[model samples]
Each structure stands twice: as structure tokens, then as C-alpha cells.
Target chain A: MKILLLAAPCLLALAVPLYNSDSPRLFGFPFFYWALIGLVPVSALFIYAVFKMDGGK
Target chain B: MIAHLNWTATLVFVAFFALVTGLGFIAGRWRAGDLDDLAEWGLGGRRFGAWVSWFLIGGDLYTAYTVIAVPAVVYAVGAYGMFAIPYTILIYPLLYLTFPRLWAVTRAKGYITAADYVDGRYGNRWLALAVALTGILATMPYIALQLVGMEKVISALGFEGGPWASHLPLTIAFIILAIYTYQSGLRAPAMIAFVKDIMIYIFVIAAVIVVPLKLGGYGAVFDAAGAALAKKAALSGKPAGLTLLPAQIMPFITLAIGSAMALFMYPHSMTGILAANSGTAIRKNAYMLPAYSLVLGFIAIMGYMALAAGIEVKNPQDVVPQLFLKMFPSWFAGFAFAGIAIGALVPAAVMSIGAANTFTRNVWKPFVDPGIGSKEEADLAKLMSLIVKVGALIVILVMPTTFALDLQLLGGVWMIQVFPAVVFGLFTRWFSGWALLAGWAIGMVVGTGLAAGPLAWTPVHAVFGLGFSAYNGLIAFVLNVAVAGALSALLPNTAPDATRAADYEDEALA
Candidate 1:
């Protein structure tokens, strides 16, 4: 279970076909650009969760 | 180039340089501690809180070259340059999993360098020496790149003169840096990091907002970059644009992952993590450090803005500096140049200290003289720090910028091979010390060979004739892990393990 949670972000990021396009612009950013930038915060939250859960150990 | 020099900007840069030099001198008294002890001098008494750690690590990681290079790559290549973004983002998760445990173990044992941990875990002096040597070798070029970053800023300000006049300013800047780092040690970089971070935020925030607004909007900037790439592609008769191509997908993923794994492996990064007050401080900063990555994402787009603004330079690394000079007022451009110049100094100081510590602790003490005391070690490290800075200056002045960049690229490939011994050793010690040594040897040879390309002599190109060419570091790392696993299973445990399992697991309890 711990391994699964850690692996999720790597999987989401490496799944290039999911976010490899020029459409779906956000605030003038392309889909490809915005999606990757969006993942920065999401990955940070996942890391926070990992840290919190480990502290409970 | 001479026409581009703005006296107002040069004055602003000089003023900031003087202010930082003053801070560097006074940092000796900040957070007063025993200067004689290696820990106090090398790691700033290992007492950095989360706030200080945040800026220190941020300034150390997001360097001056990064400020210049990331945007320059984006301007040259398109989405391919955004590899730095995912690499930076994913590094936090990697650090979250690895560094707290590393910090805990190192703190428990009073270890100053990663090689010290390797020696403690494996009970093999030779293995520790390998790690120490790799850290020092890799750090030299990394420092040289920082010099390259400063040289770009200096030259972009149109300070053309004879070769001696061209290099004189950098020489004086580095001399001041070496003296303060010698006197104040880690406190110097940590204290000055506050000023560096504030200036970077100001420059990046202003550039992102003001530059895009000056040239209509973000949409127009992107369109201009796209048009420029399309024209280049048409001329070259190849597919290229503002988005990633299918063939580029694999290289992009591999480069990003390889870089993330290698980031914390550098000695300076470990110095930053170990200097923190506790395991919790390290973890907290990992969560917050991605904020700098977000800033980097904005800075990368400024390369596109450079295209829209029609800035051109013979060297791509000068694109961002040239853009600032052309787009902003004289005073503000000077402020931007000062920010970049200071950015270079912070990392150079940290890298030199990190390399110096490895040399004094892992190499000199064990190999040369086991009777060395803490005071002697600190003094030796200070001397070595000056030597490392001088070495970096020579690398930049003697070599071309592209050659220095290739050396940094190869440094990553070489440094990552130590991971199985350092990071993985923190967990189970299933692999024997001899097996780990063998793995490192194989990784270094093959990684360097492939990164050196087909010539077996050239170290410039890293891509080889795989079905598709990829980052040589990742490919070599896979081979390293495989060889170690195989050797561990086949070979007997020839050497005794020096550390117990509880030593690693107990860190969680703290």
C-alpha cells in the first residue's frame, strides 16, 4: 500500500499520452504545459501525505 | 555588444555585490558557534530551522546557471526544455522518501559526508573512498557551470575588454567569496541566501508579468515562439514545434527521471539536508521546496518571451540576459544582473564547501592521516574550498562554455552510480560491500563509456545507438542496479557489515 501511493505520481507523470497536446489551454498555457505545471502542487501534496503517514509510524 | 552596456545597470550590480560582500563577512557572527569544530564550520552547527533551510536549499538548488540555462533551452528547443519542470517536481517525492532517513542516520552517527555513511554501513574504506572521489570529481564541473552563469551575466552587460579585463571582475568576485567562505563557512552561504532568494523572486516575478505585458500577452508570445520553431523546422526538413514529438517522449521521461534521482546525490545537496536541525526539518523543507520549481516554470516561459521580443545572441545561454537588457529599463536590468551574479556565488560557495568536506573527511583522514583532529580537518576543508574555487575558475576560463556543460552532464551520470551504496544502503544491506564496489565500478565504466559516445574518447555526447537513443545515465543506472543484485546473490558476503539494522530503523522513532 505504501509503495502504491509513492508510485502513483511517477505513473501519472510518465503517462505522456495523457497530457501531450496543445489544446485545452489554461490561462494561455497549452494543455501540455499547464498539465505538467499543475502536477507540481499535486506531487507536493502527495509527498506531504507520505510524510504525514510516515510520522504516524 | 559595447553599445548594450548601461552604466546605470553596472552601478546597480556593483551596489548589490558590495551589500552581499558585507553580509558574507558579518555571517561569521550570526548564529554564533564554535568555529574550530568541523560540524560547526562545515554544517553551520547543524541547527538550521525549516525557514532557513528553505532558502538555503532553494538558493543552492535553483542556481544561476538554472536561471540562464532553463530559459535558454526553452527558447532553443520548445517543450523538450520543460524536462526540468517534471524533474524538479518529482524530486520532492524522491527526497520525501529518502532524505529524512539519510538525515536521521547521518545525524545519529555524527557523519559529515555521504562517504562517511558509506564507510560506516559497509566497513570498507575503499568503498568510502570511491564515493568521496566521485563526489569531488563531479562537483568541479558543477562549480564551473556556476562560473559560466556569472560570465554570461557579465558579458551580457557589454563589458567587453581585453581577455584580462573580461575576467578581472569574476576573479575579484570569487576571491571575496573564497575569503568569506574560508572565514564564516556554511554560515556565509546560509545567511546570504536570504538576500539571494528575495532578489530572485523580484526579478522572476517582474520578468513574468512585465515582459509578457510589454509584448501584448502570453498568447502572442507563445505564437511567436511557435512561429520561430516552425521556421527552423522547415529549413532543417524535420518535424518540430512548441510541443513534444512522439520520438521525444522516451528521452524526455528518461532525462527527467534520471535528473531527479541525481539531484540529491550531489554532495552540496546532502550538505544542505544534513545541516538542518532535525529529520522533521528536512521533511518540511522537501514539501515546500517545490515552490521554487513553480517559479522555475515561469522563468522557463521567459525564453518564449525572448523569442517574441526578437532577442538574438551567439550563445543561447545569454538569451535571458540579453532579453532583460533589451526589455527592461537600465536600472532594473542592473538589478536583474546583480540577482544572477549573486545567485552564482551562493551555489559556488556551497559546492566548494561540500567538496572540501568530502576531501578532508573521506579521503585525507582515512588515506593520508587517521590522526587528523577536528580543528585540522576544518582548516583543511577551508583551504580545499579555496582550491576548488580556483579550479572552477580555471575550468571556465580555459574551456568553452559547451565543454563545461558537457562535463556537468557527465557529472550527473557519474554521481548517480553512488546511489546503490548511499541511498539504498540506508535500507536493507542485502548487497555486500564488495558487491556494491563492483557495481559502482561497472556503473562508472559503462556510464562514462556510453556518455562518451562511440569514440570511446569523447565525453561530449551521451546518446548511443540503442534502438532509440536515450539518456546514458538512466541506462547505466539500470545496469548498475542489475549487476549489484546479481553479484550480491552469487557472491558470498565477504566483508562484515559495520552497522546494525536498528541503526537505520531507529531513525523513524526519532
Candidate 2:
């Protein structure tokens, strides 16, 4: 479960830059407007899952 | 050539600087219990989580130097500059294995600085003293080079002064940085890193997507770069001439691998690692952080693309920013320049903080007074941190740009000397402290001699007759390891396995 959780953020990081052809705009800006838009939320979720297993930083 | 003064870009750059400076000052209070200890000031209360640590460490690692210079090399050297790509990629898996272990042990041992680890692990003040001196020495000029990167960006922004105009803003920038850093401590840089990273990602991604389109296609751009460098080599009289490839393939790999090994060992990287909250966070970052390198690879290619499109980067370091000016709309270019300009600031702050820690703890406490209070250490660290910034600014004004960059080459050669006593010391207790110091001293003398000698072709020149150059640091590392290993067998001494490693080796597997 812990290892599976770790793989999740990598999946999201891979997905955002590849699939968003419709220019998935953030805050009414261009698709490229927010670089970390996808990076942050996904990494956060993976970190949260890891925390449950190990307790915390 | 400095006349491309786009006020819009200048305005955006200054506005962002103001925003970054404000964050630095307030960060002194972040996660505050009390500002009474050096650890809190120097390492952000030593409790940074995944998020802050990610930005802080990333910001420290990926500087304006790499952002602009790597691409500039790609612009000039073809596949040669791509060395940065592989080096950055390979370094992560390496750091992931080593860094987490280092972080775990260091934290467990209550080691704030790498020298602190050297001191505790070997129980040899002389060995620890050699390591600490190397940290302070290596970091001073590395910090100076940060200001040099910012100045190149500033000059490309079209700012001009008298004969001295080139470095005046850099001096002012340091003064401003020093004040806020003194007020806030390491938290200042950590907090400011949020803004800096956002700006860099926007600029780098925008360049990767937008600029290539502006120049036609990636294929066409590479063809142009090839023609340009071939033309340059024709004039220079050397085959690998026009591009940064000066010598050949062997060197391309050496510079990359040598640099990668030395990267984490640099005091700045150690400082970045020390700021993380836990070993787990550092491990998590190890894989995730390679994402920055992905941006870096694309960023490096922009240099070749810019040269192909007839954009002349005034300073090679300003090549990426200048490319944005050539390709983008005025407003967008201003935004992009802000990213490069502000990007320089984050690393400068971190480098100054790292240098300050060396001066305060390694230089001051262990030598000046054997038993200083934590509050006094913190206070002195802040004071010295300011002085370190000032010292770097002086170097900024006086150094030739080429000389400033060469310092990194020397910095690499010098810092890697400490690996035996710091990194290897943890895994084994066999290497005697005296042997380690002897190895370190020899590496510095030989490396500095080769690097500083009069060899016209070499990056760091050479000492008198011995031919050495940019990659001399790697040579020094070899000599250091061999000497240390040989001497250890000759004189067996104490300093077996570390206390932190003992406690955690079982915890990790259990």
C-alpha cells in the first residue's frame, strides 16, 4: 500500500503535461498559465497517504 | 550591447523582487516557537514538511546559473551541453539512496551542519576542522557566483551604469538580501522560494512550449544551431570549437559526473537537506525532484534555439532571458524575465545562509569559544550571514565573470575532499581522522595548483607547468580517496560506526 501510494504522484506528474490538449486553463488563464497547478494537488495527495502509514515529518 | 532595456520587464522584475524580499523578512517567524537557537534560524526550526522542503531544496539546486548557462551551452555545443540533462537525471537516484541515509543519521545525531557530523562521527577535532574549513572556503565563492548570475541577467535587462555599472545593482541586491535574511533567518529563503519556483516553472515551461514554435520546430532549430557552431569552429582553429565542446567527448562526461558527485556534497546542498523535516520527506523528494531536471533539459535546449533564431545573448548566462525577449510579446517577455531575475535571488539567499552557517558554527564556535549558548550561536550566525553576503558582493564587483564561474570548478574540487571524512566516515570507522585531513590538504594543494596554473586552454588554467583545466576537481577527488585509503591502513585509529547510523540502521529495516 505504501509503495502503491508513492507511485500515485508520479502518475499525475506524467499525466498533466501529456494529456491536457484542450489547454486546461487555470484561473481563466491559458492552459500553460499555472505550471504547478497539477503538480501540487497530486503530490499533496500522495504525501497525505504516506503520512498515514509513517505518521509524519 | 546592453541597450535592449524593456521597461516593462524591468518593472515586473523589480515588483517581484519586492514581493520576494517581503517574504524573506516575514519567514523569520514561520513555524516559530522561539528564535532562540541556531537550528531554528539556520534550518527553519528543523521541521519543514514535504511542501516547503520541496521548494526550498529545489530552489537551492536549480539556480539561475543552471537555468541560463546550461541552455547557453546547448546553444553552443550541440549534444555536449546535454551532459547537464543526464547528470541531473542520474544524480537523483544517487541522492535518493545516499541523501535519505545522510538526512536520517544527521538529524538523529542532532547535526545541523555537515561539519557537525564530521566532528561527532570521527571524534577528531582536526578532521572535523579540515572539513569545516573546506565548507567555508568552498561556499564563499559559490555564493559570489550567484551574484554574478543575477548581474548577467540584470545587464541583459538593459540596465547600464558607468564602468562599474555592471556590478552596482548586484551589490545593492546583496545588501537588501542580507538585511532581510538577518531579520528572518533560513525561513526567509524557504518562504521566498514559493514565489521563485512558481515564476521559474512558468518561464521554463512557457519557453519549452512557446519558443520552439516561434523558431519553427525543434528539428529546424537544431539544424540552425549546427550551422552556427560549425561556422564558429572554423574560425577558432579547434574542431570542437564553436560550441562549448572545446576539447572532446571524454571531458563532456567528466564535467557532468564530477559535478554530480560533488553536487550533494556542496555545503548548500547539505544546508538544503538539513532543512527537511524527516528522512521520509527527503526520500520522497529524491524521486519527485527529478521533475525539475525535466524542465532543465528543455531549458538548456532553449539556448541552441535562441542562437539559431539570431538572438544574441549578451552574457551567456542571460541567453534564456534574452530569447524570451526575442520571441515573446512584450508583456509576456517581462513576465519571463521576472522569473529568471527572481530565480537568481532564491539561490543567492540560500547560498548566503549556507556560508553564514559555516562561518558561525564551524569557524566561530568550535574555534572562538568552546561552549557558546544556542541563542548566541543563532545570533552570531545571522550576523555572519550578513557579512558573508557582503563578502560575496565584493567578489561580484571585483571578479571577472570567467573567474567567478571558475570558482565553481574549484569549489567542486575542494569540497569533494571532505567526502572521506564526512560521507565515508559514517559507513566505516576504519579511516583515521589524521589520514583524512592529510588527504584533504593534498587534494587542495594539487587541485588548486592545476586549476590556477597558466594553461591557456583550460577553464581554471593550471599551476605553472602541470596541465589541468575545468574538470580538475575530479582528479583531486581521486587523489583524495587514494591518499586517505592508503594512510588509513598505515595508521589505524578510532571512529568506528556512527551513533545515528547505529540507532537508525535497525529502525529502518525493522
Candidate 3:
């Protein structure tokens, strides 16, 4: 389950074809740009969760 | 260029440079370990806690080159360049999974380098030599490129001199770096990274927030950048825009995944990982180090902001410096340049030390002189560190910068060839040393031949004349795995394994 959580972000971010569009802008950032940038923090949160599940060891 | 020198900025840059130099020297006594010991000098005595390891590894990996080059690529090529964003984000979870085991095993065996572990794991001195040589060879150009990054700032500062005298400031900065790294070892960079990172965060954050405001908003910036890029693509008959073209999707994904996998295999990165006191420290930093990636994301967008602000430069590499110059006040520009320049020092010192540790532990002690004692080994590492820095200095000063850039391209290709031997070996001893060495040879030959000869230094190559393309390193790395796996199946496992599975278990967890 923790592995799934960690792998989710990696898979989502690498599937570039899925988010390769420029529309649906947020704060002036294209969906393509903002989605990848947003993934940085989201990926961090997931990894942090996995770390916590590992007892933070 | 000469007339552009601002006294306010130069003074601030010099002041910050001096402050870091002083910090570099003073770091020798931090945590108060014996300077004569190899572990103390090379790996910070394996004593760095979670926070220090976070800063050190972050500073070491996301270097001055990344600061300058990522935005430069984005400025030149549009959305294709932000591959660095995903590449970086991919590595932390990778770290959470793979590197703690590496740390556990290396610490258990008192190994200072990946090559050292390779030697013990495969019991093949020849194979280990290949690993060490690849590291040193790849690192030589990398260290040179760090100077190239620093030179951009130094030249931007417009210190007055003829061609010969222009290098004076860079030379002096490096001399101080070499001396302190010799005296203090990894501790110098570990301590100074705090300053480097804080300065970077301040300048980059300010740029993202303030640059967009000055040029209307993020909307205006993206719109302007998109229009400009579309115009260029039409004029030049090239595929570049705010979004990736269908043909570009494969290259972008391959580049991101290929680079993320190869990043930790570098000797300098290994130095950072091995220096941590515990596996938990490494895993903890894995989740947090994405903060650097966040900063990198901001840095990549500065390219569009530069376009929107109407900053012009002949070299795209100069875009970031020119962007800061046009948008920020003179003093703040100086602070940013200082941040960028000192950014070079931390990595240069760490790279030289990593290459030196490889030479001393894997090459010199084993092959050159087996009788060398621990004290002598540490001394040799210190001296080799200076030599490596001087070699890099010569490469940057004497040769054309393009040569260093070319070799660095080949360096990445060369570096990933060692991955199967080191990382694969970390999990199982199923592969024999000879098979891995054979794979290494093929990968090196094919990767270098494609990069230097046929592909002419482009990272992507078409496979089998298909319409598809992929990163050359990834292509070569796939070939490497197939050969190694096949040969391992054929060859008997005669190479004696020096480590048991228990050695890779986290000591605290066990």
C-alpha cells in the first residue's frame, strides 16, 4: 500500500502525454506547466507519507 | 561588458564570497573530528545528521550549473527544458527506496566509494578499477563545468581585466576552495551549503514572485513567451512551443527518467549519501529534499519571465544573469550573483573530494601501493583532491568551454554505465563481475560512439531508424542491462562475494 502511494506520483508525472496540454490555466500557469510544478509538492507529500508509514526510520 | 559592471553589485558579490571563504576555512573544526582520518576528510567522518545531510546533498546535486543551465535551456527551447523538474521529483522517491540500502552496506564495510563496494561485492579488482576510472573521468569535466558556472557570474560582475587578468578572481576563489577542502574535507561544503542554499532560495523565490509582477503577471509572462516561441519555431522550421509536440514526448520522458536513475550513481552524489550517519537520515532527507526541486521549478519558469520582461542575450546561458540585472536592483543582483558563484564552490569542492576518494581508496591504495597506511591514505586523498581541482581549473581556463561541455555530455553517458554494477549489485550478487564489466564496455563504447560520433552530442537518438527517439543514455543503459543479465546467466558465479544480505539491512531497523 505504501509502495502504491510512492509509485503513484512517479507514474502520474512521467505520463507526460496525459498532461501535455496548455489549457485549463491556473494563476496564469498553463495546465502543462502548473501540473508538473504542482507534482513537485504532491510527490513530496506522498513520499513523506510513506516515510511516516515506515515509522520514520 | 566592461561598462556594465556595477560597483554596488560587485561589492556585494565580493563580500558574500569572502564570507563563504571564511566559513569554508572555519568548518574544519565543526564537529571536531581528526583531520588525518580518511573518513573524516572525505565523508565528514560519516557523522552528518538528517538536516546537514539534506542541505549537503541538496547543495551538492542541484548545483550552480543547474541554476544557470535549466533556465537557459528553457529560454532557448521552450517547454522541453523543464524536464529537469520531473527528473528531480523522480529521484527523491527513488532515494527513499534504493539509497538507504547502499548507505547500510557501504557503512558496514567502511567503503568510501561505490567502486570500493563494487570491488568487495564482485571481488574483481579490474572491474572496480573500471568503476573508479569512469567516476574520475566523468567528474573531471563536471568540476570544470562548475567553474564555467562561476565564470558566468564573475564575467557578469564585469571585474576589470584583460583576458588573462579576468580569470584572476576565479583563480583566487578556487585556490581558497582547494586549500580549505584539503584542510577541512567534506565538512567545508557541508557547513557552507547552508549559506549557499538560503541565498539561492531568497533570490529564486524573489525572482518568481517579483519578476512576474514587474512584467504584468504570470499570465502576461506565459503569453509573451508562447508568442515569441511560436514565432521562432515558424521562422526556424523547428518544433518548439509552450507545449511539447508529439515527437517530443518520448525524448522528454526518457530524459527525465534516464537522468533521475543516473544521478545518484555519480561519485559526488555517493559521497553525500555515504556521509550520512544513518539510513534513517537518508530516508528522511529523501522526502524533504524536494524543496530544492521546488526551487528548481521556479528557476525553470524564469526563462518565460525573461522573455516577458524583454531581456535579450546572445547566449541563452546569459538569460538568467541578464534577467536579474534588468529586473532587480544592483545590490540584489550582486547578492544573486554571489549566491550563484558560491553555489559553484560547494559542488566543486565536493566533486573533487569524491573523485579523490575514488582514486585513493580504489586506485592508489589497492593498485599503486597496497602497503599504504590509513594516515598516508588520508593524505593521498587530500593531495589528490587538490590535483583534481587543478586539473579541472586547467580544463576550464586553457580549453574552449565547449570542450568541457562536450565531455560533460559524454560524462553522463559514461556515468550511467556504472549503474548496473553498483546499484544492481546492491540488491543481489547474482551477476558476476566479468559479465558486468563486459556490459560496461559495450555501454561505454555504444553510448560514447552515439554521443560523440554519430549523434554528435545530442542526448536523443532514433532507434532502428524508427520514427521514435529516446535519450541515448537510456538506450545504451537498456543494452547494458540485457548483456549483463544474459552473460550473468551464462557465466558461472565464480567471483567471490564479500558481503552478506545482512550487511545491507538498516542497522537501527534490525
Question: Which parts of model 3 are misplaced by more than 4 Å?
Answer: B1-4, B453-455
- Please give the lDDT score for candidate 3: 0.91
In model 3, the Cα lDDT at residue B255 comes to 88
Expressed as tens digits, the lDDT of each residue in B1-510 for candidate 1 is 356566899999999999999999999899899988889988999989989999999999999999999998888878888989888877887786788778877777889999999998888989899999999999999999998899888887778887778887888999999999999999999998999999999999999889889988887888898998788678887655779898888788888888888889899998988899877787787678988998899899888888889887777788988899888998999999999999998999999999999999999999999999888989999999999999999988777777778888889988889989998888778887888888889989888887765543332233556555567788888888998899899986667766665555434445
Compare the candidates by TM-score and give the number of the best one: 3
Pairs of residues clashing in candidate 2: B71-B300, B75-B304, B76-B243, B429-B496, B453-B462, B453-B463
Q: After superposition, how far is residue B315 of candidate 1 from its true place, in Å?
A: 0.9
Candidate 3, residues B361-473: lDDT per residue as tens digits?
A: 99998898999988999999999999999999998889988899989888888888999999888877889899999999999998987776553578888888778998888
Name the candidate, 1 or 2, with the larger DockQ value: 1
The 10 consecutive residues of candidate 1 chain B with the worst lDDT sum are B455-464
Runs in model 1 with CA error above 4 Å? A55-57, B1-4, B237-239, B454-466, B505-510
DockQ of the candidate models in sequence: 0.60, 0.04, 0.82
Quality of candidate 1 docking, DockQ: 0.60
Interface RMSD of each: 1.8, 10.6, 0.9
